[model samples]
Target chain A: MARAGLNAERLTRAGADLADELGFDQVTLSALASRFEVRVASLYSHVRGSADLRARIALFALAELADRAADALAGRSGKDALAALANVYRDYARTHPGRYAATQLRLDPETAAASAGPRHAQLTRAILRGYDLTGTDQTHAVRLLGSVFHGYVSLELGGGFDHSAPDTEETWSRILDALDSLLRNWPD
Target chain B: MARAGLNAERLTRAGADLADELGFDQVTLSALASRFEVRVASLYSHVRGSADLRARIALFALAELADRAADALAGRSGKDALAALANVYRDYARTHPGRYAATQLRLDPETAAASAGPRHAQLTRAILRGYDLTGTDQTHAVRLLGSVFHGYVSLELGGGFDHSAPDTEETWSRILDALDSLLRNWPD
Candidate 1:
């Protein structure tokens, strides 16, 4: 029988928490069921399988991140918006490492299309307006900013910058400053 | 009997090739042995195991990529250096997909310390001289550039930008331009 007070939403939230604790790879139907004091078959009722659970967590993370970005960017522009957007991603990665990792997993085109990922892109594009870019240049800038932000956060999270050379936090701020400067004087 | 003219180097190279064709995760000892017309047991004599073989391939890729970056950046500075370095990575990812992906896999500290990854950081720092950044800011810019290039390329390779946008090539150029602009006009 399905466990009392156990539902898909509760299971998905627990799965996300477990993801932050163990990692995305370690999150499984069995684990979630155990956490809820239920059986594996019971989890199958809420989640199709392990993949479905992971995908749901990914969607949750993308939405949460987009929401934070939207909130951060509100009433902000120019460098303010840029830093806000960048920080939202970096913070999310740090706070929810497992969920952040899931965001990198490849999804089917249709699933990706339906994901909250587009909202992240839109928020970034909105921030670019402060720089006066239009058309293809703006699009290009948005793509670049997304790349650098995601790339930097991914590497940093992976401990790529664990060296003794100036702490990463110091470097992150400087990079934000440089990004602002670049947008102000984009090359011809 | 071992296949005529079969050896570890050949096996590693073969594995690397298979990686390019199938992806890093798909490369396996049984598959490599099967492809080489040898039993899996016989293949064990040449390499420690699947993990060992992958590690060697990762080192091979790091050295090879560092060499390419060195050649590309030879006597180049600023935008030229940035573009060439970035291109080496992108081109390598495109041409040697498996090996490139392996480069992202976690390496043992000893192996990583011996790897040519240091050369990459040095090259990036070299490009920074053309910009006005110094001390912590320079360090930050280095990290930022690494994040963007890697993040953008990984996402693109994973088909993150395959639809609903301009061509990836255009985006790549725009990113390099943005990086150069950002670096040249670094914030105070």
Candidate 2:
């Protein structure tokens, strides 16, 4: 029988907490076992190993992010929807850096297809409904937005904007404004 | 006496090559020592340890990237300059994933200030000269471009765009177009 308080979900959540505290790279099975006061062999019953634990954490992060994004996009539209969705990612990264990092883990195709990855892509597409894009233009815009949101947040988190004047929050709002303008008047 | 054929510069360069072959996280003093077929202790003369070695590699990558950005930005302006600069990052990341990852490493403020990091900022500012941005708008635009460039390259490298339709090249060029239009329009 499984341990009274330990299951795959429970262990995965603990691993994520460990990641948030010590960083995703540090959330190994052994470290998790130590945290749970169990032997590494005990974790093997719940998680295959380090990679499996990491993947589960990654999937968990993706699902959590998708849930937040869905909620943020609930009633918003146009630039409102755009900003809301963008904030979902940036805010998630800020509150949960380690889990955010896990979301970037490159999953195998089969696993990724089954994960919340598609929900993310779909949410991005829904944001485009507010703009005047179509055909390949929609696809292009989606990629552009993904790049900007991911790029800006990671750079900010990495201290890329620390030494610069005009704080990041101001820049972020302006970026959203600029993106809105770009989408409204996308080039031919 | 020091080893006849080994030195700090050579070790750093070899470490970078190892990064390109393996991932950046895998580059360590012990690993570099194995690559050089020398005792790990022998490397203490060149580097403090794994962190020091990684920092050196990061500095090397920042300088190399700055050099390439400068080369790409020369004799170009407006969209021409923008495309050239953008391509520099994408091409570099594609050709040298590990070294590219090193460029993202967070260094101490003093080390970052002395490194070629500032040159990257200056080159980015030069590209903005082609546009009408002034004051913090320039800074915001700079941040935006950095975010987009870094974000897009990392996502593409991570296969975020692999499962999508419309080849990344098409989306890339369109993104450039959208950025150019946004910069030229400069929402009020």
Chain A only: TM-score per candidate: 0.96, 0.96
lDDT of 1 by residue, A48-141 (tens): 8888888888888888889899999999988988998999999999999998988877788899989988887899899988997878888788
lDDT (tens digit, per residue) of candidate 2 on A1-188: 45547789999999889988988888888888888888888888887888999999999999999999999999999999999999999999999999998998989988988999889889999999999999999999988999999999899888788887999899999999999999999999
Candidate 2 interface RMSD after superposing interface residues? 0.6
- Model 2's lDDT to the true fold? 0.91
What's candidate 1's i-RMS value? Answer: 1.3
Best by DockQ: 2
User: Best-fitting candidate, measured by TM-score?
Assistant: 2
Model 1 per-residue lDDT tens digits across residues B30-90: 8998897778888778899989999888888888888998899899987988999999899
> Per-prediction interface RMSD?
1.3, 0.6
